[model samples]
Target: MLNGGPASDDHERLLLAIEAAGLDLWENDLVAGKATLPATRTFRELGYSREEVGDTLAFWLEIIHPDDRPAIENALVAYRDGRSDNYRAEFRLRARSGEWVWYANYGKVMSGSVETGLNRFIGVTFNINERKHREEELARINRLLSAQNQQLDQMNAHLEMLSGTDPLTGLFNRRAMNECLHRLTRSAECEAGVLFVDLDDFKKTNDIYGHDIGDILLCQVAQRLQSCISADDMIARFGGDEFVVLIHGRGEGGVRTILEAACERILNILGQPYVIGDLLLNACGSIGVACFPTHGTTVESLTKRADIALYRAKRQGRSLYRFFDSGMELDLYNRDSLEKALRAALKTRQLELRFQLQVDRNLRPIGAEALLRWHHPVRGLIGAMEFLPDAVASGLVHDIDNLVLENACATLGKWQHDPELRGLSLSVNITARAFDSPSIAPAILALLAKFGVPPEKLCLEITEQLETRSFVTANTAITHLREQGVRIALDDCGTGFSSLESLKSLSFDQVKIDGVFIRDINTNTVSQAIVAGLIGICRAMGLQVLAECVETPDQMEYLLEAGVDGFQGYLFGMPLPCAVLEAGVRDAPQSQRG
Candidate 1:
């Protein structure tokens, strides 16, 4: 038999459901001041028995979290005092087996002695501990993500600074230069000059002391450059021995004085021997200056003009400075046009060569130097001096060398039977690119074999600048040629890299004193001293000495006294074609010929 009251049956069913759902249902008889509760359904789930029923509210209250018990009691007291009609709270409770769990309790309060069955308290409690733990874990991950983001920001800033800096020199690089130039252009400031400085024959430093020492020397140069420029000015390394200085000051005289002082200091500092490990060496720099507003209005225009001035300064003899002018641009454009034409000419065979006689001290034609002449259909005879530099700069000299070598060998075969020219030699000036060819030495040997000419009847003249690359392969090639009985001469020795060490290291058969120094030997004590020193070194090394640009008898007499073994200039004879030279040798009186 069962009680059939509707409200009591509904209440019993609700209690049974709460117990089955792993919750403990509690009821307080306020009039009796007693409390009763079912055994926790969670107890069965955790391998415990339902016989462990609670007798009073204190039994359950004892299992409430210690910190939350006082708040729960206070809230209960407020509800009992009629201060609140409903109660809701979240707090910690001990579940079966003494594990802590979070519980949410919500209920409606009923006043005492109600007549209707509806006047009864009701509430529910739920386990929410797993959801609370997941929330805490998500909060920790968010904090970690914030920390990573902050570190990334710092790293990005550092990378930006490093990108604009030259790693080796520790100065601003060309990329930084572009940014700074734009800023300067937008400013109202006037009178800024861009000086492009290049270390003269820097390749020689690398050859002599190795690239490690060259790197140290470049760092020292950067430090010196920083000291030369004012705080308001900027200096950036424009890649490999080239640096551009931006000076923000007024007055041409002041600029010149500052530039000269800077140049003199740089030369003087670098002139001192650089001591690396056990070796000591020296180097110098050439500066080309182009003043803003005076040279051009834009950075590109000014830099291009400065480069032209730099080229002219290097060509005229390095370790000096030159200012840019409008003529440099005109000359540059003309050369550019000529270079395009030259490239086309090589393909069309419009280029040709004519030989010039090389006379000995006795006025006998011992050799004929192969001189290049261009017979452009529209431009007539384009001289070697006019287009040779353009060819070299444009990297077309290799084509010209092959063309000339093939022609010269064929011409030598024709002259092989001539009695006066049978034993004579042919000298050719070798360019830097020509030596880079793996076939240059072999080509010359093949040419000699084809012509049935002796190796001693061929001479190769190279500038001292070409000797800067101490590449073992290049050295091996040159050594192989010299072993084959070819004579090598270092041309323009006095004004370029003419150090006693360089000469001894390269071991050339001849040293040609540059004509500029020889031209003023009688009047310039400095020129006389340099030539004497070089001649003395040449003689000591068993290398023959040749003086060039002898236009006066007094100059010839001075060079003769300076121990030069040979002279070649207008004073003796100009460079004449091979036919005229042979006729002069054949038709001249025997006294004049000898």
Candidate 2:
């Protein structure tokens, strides 16, 4: 076998395999300063004939990329000089078909001869263009994926914003309201303020104009509210017709200024009539302001107080703003005490039903109005006007209302039993607050039962303001009461919001001309004309009329000519004690019956 040792023979076989396996083999003679190459079956596969096999180093150098030749030559020189035993490089080369391909070339010296100061080194280079090309494609895809991931992150942020924002106005939604509140609480250094703004009669706008126009108005209001606040301040749509503004600052002045400015701007913008399609509409708003550390320390307390202020603002009037006031607490407390005393007064007979006599045109006693009097053991006597608002404020009007009704019924029952006063009707003043209670009618029925008084002898008088404001509710209550044979009287007509609309919507048995118009009827022609017009309207509606505050004889003469059905004022008598009323009814002449 033409072989050296096993290792040597293996080297020879490898060299032969490189030629037979269609590869290019080259040797550099370090001492001789020459280079040679042997092209094997690789030359044939590469379109190289046998004649091309006998080539020098220049022939192989031609295939290497121009840019990579220097580095490839340096690596090969270092390996052949024995500085490094291994040589590896990557380069671009032209293939046999005249196309450039990326390749990674790796080789090692086959052997070295040192005799005659001459060294020969053998190495082989194989094509790895496909592997290198695949790696480059993979790297390009990785870069693209990195850029796409960054863009997706930005898109997710935008989606999160859209989810939390109100679509119509680009403000925060209710969810954001809660989140901002919580965040404010968490920030120990942050001072928080809340301004609760409620649009006045917002539903009226929607009802008068179409909802589409209402939406435009709301959007406009939102823009004005937003513009009035600072960039750092946040405004959120708490719900329909309600917006909450949150600001971080030390002094409440900043919050107040912002809220007031917002309110003023909103009012100014909405105050001008809105022209929607063919109709013009007007609307306004009320703002309730509550500040942290002053109004409340916690989120719940702050919101509660803010809502309380909002309720007060609505009660005062629309298009106004109110800050949380500590005085409201004192008022609320006093109201609570009055309510408790009222409930106790009802049970303990501390309340009185005094009768005020009503006379006819001829100065003959016809009937009386039941006046409620509270006999406080310590506070002395208190009238309805003195504590009625307190009762209404404390939500205790219903208790006092039932007591008055019971007392009036009992007194009337006693008077009705007397032959002298058998025909006398009793008119009782009913507060508008009493009508708000759903149990008012049922309580009346109970009072009639407890006192054994007939419903026909009782007349419930309600104010004109109540009549105009709550026509439907008052009408329903009065209708149910009348079906039980009780009479209804429209009190204080010809003053304070009275109109024919009351007569058209509610059928009252009687109309009492207000004391204001009747007080000066003798001297004031306008007052006489008003009373005359009211009596005429009442007659037309088949309603009996009564004139209040009949003081002078000339006034009485005026009312008499006005065809007044009944009269009650100081002219008949100032409000009398029960004993005085009893004596008056007993001492009447036969022809002048009471």
Candidate 3:
């Protein structure tokens, strides 16, 4: 071990310290191409005995892992040529157990300079197997996390697609359609033709065959529409029996003809018969057409114009299409003017309630139904049917309904003192918008208290449409009123989609049969059977039955024989103002009182 000279005390101390730290010292002779390795505890632990120490540089290179050999050789050459001051590399070496052990090797020139053609490297090798294993495990974990993140990204995309798509028809929904319209309007180069399609008499189909079949029919309609359009066209379901399509990239010259051809193709396709299960159903559609920069440029304007055109199509007879024209714009202007005037009427308190008597079979007054009337300055007396649609569309019907309720309560309070009218109750029709208000019950109760009228003397009328469409809100309002001793009556009962179901589940004090069946009951056998069946059902359910629109003596006799509990029609006297009604009641004889 001691070849050239005796080691000084400082050198011997350094060697003892290095051995104590479990390190093996290595020396490389660049000129001789030989290496000297100390027989330290680390070398022994690596299964290299004293005989294995002082190996040549070739023997050290042979022990290095094949993958790391080139790196180690290059690092040594660079250091010898003075390109680098030191050499460092981590590599695996074969051990006595035939296993690969990781080691960190670091070295620097020791005694001679590369310029002098004489050089020696002094370095240490240390075991680093535990740290290497930890690094590999962390790498594996990162790979796994990366894979999971990719899968999550894919799932999020799928969920987004589902949210924007209709489950039943596999088409874009209203929200997605609105977004698409917004995008199309923003692009200056994009020209689109919009078609608003509504199924003709869809409600009749639903009423006759039920909603399950109706759903199947809608699905079939969607398939037919899809088959009629190209891949670049967009189709969306805008809720219940209504669909919209956007035909992209409009052609130049003959654009109207192109749109007309497309519309005709759609009409022809949708007019085909659909066979669902064992039932063969015939249906048709009404389409309204609008084009970008022609009928409208914005989504709202386009959709509104399309709706106006659709109305014209339906008005001209079903199974047809109509392009938007300027005449429809006048209709819109008129509707807007009407809505503004109605709002002004509400603020100025120009609305009045007329009371129509509900009489017993003996034609004696027992109650009165409040009908809304608007006395416009220029339009003369406007019936409820003339202005109520505009009012409802403008979201002003709730205010109108509240005004009627307050008036009815005040009328009842005044009639409580009149001996002839004291026993008569007053019924007021509630609009669907008013009934859906969460504050409706509290507002009505407050009115009754303010007028000092008993709740039993007030009746609230709700349509079958309201009861079926908004079951929860209607039921809550009904239950709250009933608990306050107010009577609840289902008005126009046999005209909605789910009348029988609503009657079975909802608590109603009376069922006012629709005027359609009552007006024909005297001659139509089917009307008689339906009226009789309704009467029997009401009797079995302990509900009072009233027939509306009774005009003739024969109609009156038929309803009376059918066990109707009450009659409300022109025959019992038309709707009269409150003051006129009070005067008439005061002039009536006590023998006519029910």
Candidate 4:
């Protein structure tokens, strides 16, 4: 215990204290490469004898565990060289039980030898396996926590995607579009265009085919709209049957040009026929465009203007696009006022029907076309074609068609006793929207029965637009109505998107050659030829050909020679009130006037 003397009483007490604390102490001689091990209870704890494990540092280094050997060696070297006040290291050691036990070694210079300076060191080895095991458990728990946090982050990202995406179309929803628009408007020198596209007559598709097909159509339209813009642009399903496109145009006039091109592409692409299952669907879109900084700076203002322009597009005629103009705001106000007035007209019975005489080639009155006229108290009289499109957009055309049917039945009933008018067929114009309603046929049948008028005397004129929009519904309505002895006429034939294909698919009793051809029939050889071809086709198909807008005597003479079965237009008679027509039906080729 002492360097130069035998163990003193105090030294013996300290050695007893160190042994009592279960500290295994040892000493190393660097000069001779020898080590001494104290006779501590480690010999028993390791289940080894002093003779089995010799007092050699090489043996301890061999069993100290390969990972901890370097650090333990470094600590001993530092203390021996006086580079550190003390040397300590924690490491693992293989016990006699073939398991690793954690231990800490601490050392200090016991003395310098005469042969070499600082040649000796002494240290204590203590078990630290329990503490190390606790640390390892804490580390494992931290790793688990870190993995959970990463999973939580990924889940949050997925939730955000679902919230922003449309469930059916997979495009961004309105919330996402609004956020994007806000960011777009705030961008520096923001140059962009917003196109608000609403599908024309989409509700008819839903009503006729069911909502499932309608959803598929919406998705198909979304794909088409996506094709119309570049990757820099965004197309989102803004609402039901409506999509919003945000295009980034980089320059001054470039925005307007890009917007126009995009809108045109949208109309053309979306207007393409969709073949779903066995059904071939024709869907079209009306686009309203507003350019950033030109229309307005804010997102709300720009979207509002775009919407206003969209209203104009649908009203002017769907399947087209309109750019927002300052004049549109006034037009919108006027349209709103007109919508109110039209509704009031329906309620107050200001809506009335006039009769345009449809006669045979011999100038004998054969039938009358029921023309819709609004006898506004202030604006005098307005024709149906002038305000009917706007009325359709305002959701009032269906009501108007119903009223027309009712009035036509009433007028036909009044003509029952007159010898001249009793034989007349009453042609009533039905709107495309009315064909979408399932009640149209039943209502017509009911009205005819109620008024004691024969269904054979009622001719329903349906435009080619109706045939092209949804031939399924048109054919269904036409078949059902025709089967009940109600005659169906293809109105304005060869003047719309419908082709000869429409003629082959739809069944009709009559085909009215559009007025456009008749307008120039006297001098325009091309018009004359088209009218002749149409008449020949109708004759071949067993459909009676009626020439509309026959204004001049030459036109009427030409149509009669061309084998036109019936004639209508200003030449025979202008549209007159049904009351005046009921007064005496004398508007004939004999008089050339109403």
Candidate 5:
């Protein structure tokens, strides 16, 4: 029934509420089969204005989408029959504009309970067309993504094969080797031997011929190693220039013999020359052998011990082999002890700088290179080589390097007062760790400034190790040092892979020919030729060439004839304390000569 007297005010307020909430109010008289008047907002929002819409309940139901009509009808019957607590639907209505617009409706029998006769059904609806469109688009994208993920799963399956093999040499990669070792050593009774092979000076070969030649060498090495192992045994490229061979079955002594033979065989085979792209390259390998049950029972232990033996072999010289021994374990303890002592050496004043004099071709002292010496109470005088590697690994080398820089600068300061020493330069060995560091140039410059030493009077001797470091970083440091008039020399040239690259790319005031070449320069025609070639190249580049390990006058005379600008070795004199060297050079300079 329509509202009487005061009810009209309440009805007007209800209409205001509907308009404020952006909602359309509607009512259905189910007993009469009539819906809300066509003038309602629901019809206006659908572009029908009022004339196109009808007031009958059947006409309102007809506007619902065909697919949604059944559910909406079922929901209405269920609610009216007391089967559902309420009536709600999301459906689309056909608009006068010929497009279907979505809506949401909630309704209730407002006049009476479901069990009693109901007079009227009331509901509110709001347009939901934009929300429905977004949901549909999201569902479509999800279907596409699901299909793409299925394709990716298939692609991932194909990449699994590439993981087990090295791309360059097609050999079993390190991960594959690890898996193989796990399978082989599952039983403790398994008897096997591992030979860890590292190619000697392969890095230098790369610097000389490029990575293409390096890859060829690795492939050839892989092939040669494959020849040494049986089908049952496994061979893998362990990474870098290193390879590993796993051999199975061996009697106690026979196994020992077999393992030795295998190591020697591998060394001999890899030592042969290779013809790589019109270049005849000589390559050698060092093998470290570790037998199962003898060196270790597990894969990790065996490989680790084998690597230690490999380090020993490399230290012994090129083209060598060494079995894992108990002494190498002792060396670990010794290294720890040496590092502990080094940490304290600086404070105890036991770390001293001994100057090895550098002489011109005329045999006159031009400068001296400072060599770090650790005068241990028990070990006597420990050479830098004995502990420097540990120092570098332990990060103690930077402090040690700082000490050398300060001492050399201070020595230069002292020489400024003596006319005989004023013209001399002091060379300090800066390890790659110190030289490539960002602070090295500033630290050296600060020290020189503090000591009032002439920049030209200080020279930094760096090995080819810097070549393996960031080229830009090392090159920048060199530029900074040389820009300030300090001298830079490449030490131990021809001993490492990057010497050629370093000499060619970086600016150097001098290049020191390694002692290896000078030691046999007289009889070794190869050494003579290399030395002659280096000298000629240095001269052509306008770089001063210096030779180390000059002992005999004949060796000195040979290097001098090769146009070497300077010499330093035992032939000139042993490394001496600055006080003794200064006193002797001032006193009997001739007597100081060896």
Candidate 6:
């Protein structure tokens, strides 16, 4: 209140500025050992009145948040000891309303030393609560985003796993398998091997039992295959009835033994009966093995070589295993060459039908079986054993069958007027592929009509293996041919699957005993018994029985005693050209006539 002088005017101006800024001023008098707040407006804003302003430092610290008290005390001590020239701190203080407000406190030591202690300190405080609230909100948002990003990372990892897996079997897919093969080839410590497994005749199961049962069978097969392998081995479904197994950490010598053992194990497991719904089904698999840096060095090469080996297994007969060899490549080349040549042979008339005479029990000629012979221009004469498999593999067996049927019917037509060859029956072998054709019966009937040959003079021979597939169509074909007066014979009986079942189900006029049983009939009791049993079965089924490969006199005598109605073998005559058979028939003695 009072001075009109310049110093008083400056003090008044400063007080007015502090009030306008809403700041509270405080001071500590070290000499007097006391602290004071001259204006209490800042404290009052926190619900503390002017009467509540404390005179001591301890009383002032009591209002501070317990977590903030130590920092403010430390700052005051640092300024007083001359370690710091200013006292600055930001902390929370409690209000009378039980709320907390952030305060930024700043002060400086006016007079003090290490020897005398602090003489005075002056400070001011301002509210900074709004800024602190904004900072805390930003920190909370950052934490939530971090948590979300972690969950997203986990989801992405699961999606990646799903992409590389087969959904039905839970095995790795081809893409994942290729990646694994690449990784194996890149490594140098151990050699790797690949086994290509194909389930035998899986498509037949699908056709007979429906796709649902087929799918269940595939899943069961996957489980069985998994059990056959070790934990370190990798297996993958290469799509439809095919699987690939990757073998690791084996040397050349051990790899073959290991692969063979694994293949045998897999075969045994797969061969066990599978029960789907109420039905039990039997299945088997064929495995082809190829090794790293041996059969091939790359994924493509190894897989291709393994596939080639698989083809060889199926060709040799299903439900077996084969290793990839250098010779297999030559075999493939030869097969391809043979397929091309056989196709050309059919087109160029290089294929011929030779006739082998089938004689009655009295050794009189009753019929002739037409055999296909391939006369390659470069390779020379090739029998059915040499080129027939290639023909089947190349999808040309049906065409070859057509040619043979056409030529046989034409030959029979020419012999119709010959006294010695009249009423002689001609039997033509039919391939399984021909049975798959819906027009087979009509085609053969049309050929017989075109050549003016009687239906009773022609016979069709099919192997026992035809029973293994969908036989409904084949049964229909057989019935149609029989209705037209053509006879059906089950060829190579007792050498293939379910011969008796085939005879019981299909309409067959005759059953020719395979050469295997006849080859050792005289020396082996088992062969004699098997032949006798087959003959009895055929007689009971009302089917004619013929014994093939009757070479020795003992074989013929034993077959004659066994009541075989006809015989066909080298003992009678070798397969001859049409002119030779005609000459032999005309020149034969009268006693030889049937």
TM-score of 6: 0.65
TM-score-better candidate, 2 vs 6: 6
Top candidate on lDDT is 6
lDDT of 1 by residue, 66-140 (tens): 998777767766666668776666677676668877776766645443333223444666667788778768888
Worst 10 residues of 1 by lDDT: 111-120
Q: What is the lDDT of residue 221 in candidate 3?
A: 95
Q: List the residue pairs that clash in candidate 3.
A: none
After TM-score superposition, the amount by which residue 593's alpha carbon in candidate 2 deviates from its true location, in angstroms, is 1.1
Where's the lowest-lDDT run of ten residues in candidate 4? 585-594
Clashing pairs in 6: none
Model 4 regions lying over 4 Å from their true place: 1-161, 220-233, 251-253, 257-284, 315-321, 417-421, 467-469, 494-501, 515-524, 550-558, 569-573, 586-594
Error of 3 at 495 (Å): 20
lDDT, residue 493, candidate 4: 81
Cα error of candidate 5 at position 89, Å: 37
| TM-score, every prediction | 0.70, 0.58, 0.57, 0.67, 0.50, 0.65
Model 5 clash pairs? Answer: 204-497
For model 6, residues 253-287, the per-residue Cα lDDT tens digits are 67778788888998889999999889898888998
What's the lDDT of the predicted structure labeled candidate 5? 0.83
Model 1 spans with C-alpha error above 4 angstroms: 1-102, 106-122, 189-195, 204-211, 230-235, 246-272, 288-309, 322-325, 358-365, 392-403, 413-421, 431-443, 446-452, 462-480, 489-594
Better of 1 and 2 by lDDT: 2
User: On TM-score, who's better, 2 or 4?
Assistant: 4
Better of 1 and 6 by TM-score: 1
In terms of TM-score, the best-performing candidate is: 1
Cα deviation of 377, candidate 5, in Å:
0.6
Residues 297-330, candidate 2: write the lDDT tens digits: 7778787777777767876756777788987666
- lDDT for 535 in candidate 3 is 89
